[model samples]
Target: MGDIQAYLASKYMSGAKADAILSRSEAGRPKKKKRRIDQAVPVAVGDGTGLLIADEDSLGNGWGQAEPEEEDTDVPVVTAAAKTLRLKKSNWSLPSASSSTQPEPAAEEPPAESSTATATSAPPVKKRKGGLLTAAQLKEEAEALAIEEARKEAEREQERLEARRRRRAEGIEDDEDLANDDDDDVDDHPDHQRTVYRDRSGKIVDAQAERAEQIKAEAEDRARQAAKKDWNKGLVQRNQREVEAQRERQVASTSFARSANDRDMNDELRNEVRREDPAAAFLTQRKKKGPQRPKYTGPAPPPNRFGIPPGFRWDGVDRSTGYEAKLFQKINERSRKAKEAYQWSTEEM
Candidate 1:
């Protein structure tokens, strides 16, 4: 019986299958390492309830009927159970169908009550469009920015005005110092004292007289420059006018010379024509007669034997017309002979 079964098995087994079986058998067919179930460490299921079951044997039996086991005394077992409980709770609370398929999020377990309270109390943050503000919010923000810019500009303007006032004050002080220096200079110089003058009314007028003279000299120089400029301008205009007039005169003279040459050429042509053909010249000079009809005096003279007039023998009639005339004559002769033969035949009959 063992030999029969072995032959049947060998017949059914392929060469590759036999090789695989042989290899596996030679390798001692690796024993599946049994997974150690930590009875103390509670298995967390999808349900959020933290009720602990005894072991795998109890887990296979419906969870509803399974009695809760005593808490493990080991610290690690308690920590792991606590972690699993947190993970289950978080997974249960998540509002996503995909959360069931995903592996448990490996995160530090947060207090359930605190997380729930925060989630409940805080309003859901709405997603923004392109992470940007709405139109109204943007407009308000722009107005605020513009107001801030205007305030800063006003402050800068104020600072500028203050700086300008300070500068003006400094300038005034400098001018006062310069005036004092000028007074000191006047007191120190003997020439200034000698030049100083007062009118009978006791008003100082020497500087005014010098300034008037200086202004008069400046005016004269400006006037001289203006007159020189005007004179130069007039001279340039006169030269331009004269140049234009000369150009016009040259153009007129050239035109007159050309006209004279044309007239002379016409006269020479007339004289040449008179020498070449005097009769043609006389015909050209003759007066033209008015239109008149010719008188019908008589019939034309008969052509000679050669079918040409006496004066037209050298200039014979056109060949095409002569052929037509000969054909007409032959046709007339044939018609006459036919008529005469018909008369003779009638007399004989």
Candidate 2:
């Protein structure tokens, strides 16, 4: 190896001799590690494309072999040429001309982190598609998205109607223009144009029948409202009769209570009732059409139970006034006699 290096470095060597020696070294130096399919990627190439090349057998793998079909021999040759041009920078190995063994393409491996093999190896190459969006597919997807958007809009409108019903039940008034927005024609005619099951005639028949049913419902609602109004009028008269009967009962009970109070001779109680209605016969005392005040005549008074200084006149009955006065006179006369008796007894002692 050192001798070869020294000879190669000699100033006297010709370029041809140097090249021959270098080629021999390449042959003897052991085949550059065969490009494994695990490393070397396969790609279909364009034929007759004027693509460049290196050599027939130089492609790191057994890539030059032609298929059985002979009509397009140029296809494989040109494809091999293009592949060689694309990957020539990679250190490729070729078999010596005299060698009988053909090299086999090894299995290609993907990049390490995203693969199960080939750690620290070269990253995998990816082919690029021509444009961002393909023509036909974009059109199809755009149509689908437009249909999906329409469906979502219809769902939103249905939700709005249901929300309005809930608000009305809660007694909240919704704005008229917003709440009454009409459904679009597309919403009304959603599947009518699709006609998956029915022929054109069935669609027209169904539409007419649906409209007739709607008219019938409106007529029924009008009849119901008229009947409800008549029933309500009868209910109003019945309620009024009940209210009048209750008032009459209240007046009769008041008269009975006033008569009871008069029989008890509760003058203060009578005055309070008269104050409520000063001119009512039920409250005022009855008179026998006389011009004189009545005189008092009663038995001697019963003794006062709790020493309430005797002349306690009962306010309402005029006849009881003299009885109270006589009782007080007796109490004072007895008191004067007891005082005189006490003085006479003391003088004697």
Candidate 3:
């Protein structure tokens, strides 16, 4: 019963549950494992007769308060300085807590591609205007400026080179700088501007103006030599226009030598050979001269192909070309295609 009470109490089981379990069990149940009463459970001790106990602090091996586990801060430390004579060198004092600052995390940088994209997306800045700038922006701008400057400088050099090349191609001195050197020295002569000689017609020949004219004449002579062509005229080509004009002149003169009957037969033909408009006798060729439409009041109409006056408007029909015939052709074509949404001749047909 004591063993049963020990087991039941140890398990914190009620008496009714134990009794029911025991009642359901058969008599052939295995024997319980034996344990000493002192080892199994505590029984009642004597009243007010407690055993003597030592001071907890005076006990060995796990006596006082347990030292807390040291946290793993892993901070570096400095020991006191050792003597220089020793192989292990001097040590320094640890830094003060106030002096130590918590290190901040470094900021993450954007990708290289993103930086370049931003630089390209931004418009080119000629001058770094009053604004904060990024390194990428400055770098791109500097590169653009370098390329632009190099291109401009190359263009100027190319122009200069082309000028020199053209001078050489035209058979002239390419060194244009020295071209005026000869004139510079000569023009500086004291008497270059003064009259130094006189010709027979009292012309100021030695003056700078005369010298300039001489130089210009010499240049013209050189140009004339350069322009000289080797024309060996071999063919005698008769001009039809000139021969016809000569024949017309002879015919006009021959009219005067004709018999008087021929000349006096028509007053108009007789006067026409002598530089006169001789049609005034019969044909009223000239108009009765006056403003035809009394100076148009409004804007003039568009001019026609014929030289008729501005007020004349023609009918819309152009009977000259076969436009009416083509209209019938187009009408037949439209009738043929009217049944279809579009002309199949341009497609499957």
lDDT values of the candidates?
0.61, 0.58, 0.57
How does each model score on TM-score?
A: 0.15, 0.15, 0.15
Considering TM-score, where higher is better, how would the candidates rank from best to worst? 3, 2, 1
Write the number of the candidate with greater lDDT, choosing between 1 and 3: 1
For model 1, give the 10-residue run with minimal summed lDDT. 72-81
Off by over 4 Å in 3: 1-127, 174-349
lDDT of 2 by residue, 133-226 (tens): 7777677666766666776798899997788888888888756634354444555676746534445666434556677999999999999997
Position 49, candidate 3: lDDT: 45
Clash totals for all candidate models: 0, 6, 0
| Best lDDT among the predictions, by candidate number | 1
Instruction: Report clash pairs, candidate 2.
Output: 37-106, 37-107, 37-108, 38-107, 38-108, 38-109
Candidate 1 scores a C-alpha RMSD against the true structure in Å of 33.4
Model 1, span 44-150: residue lDDT tens: 44443655333465444455244545542323332234345443233334346665556655788878999888875534333334666888977766676666677
What is the TM-score of candidate 2?
A: 0.15
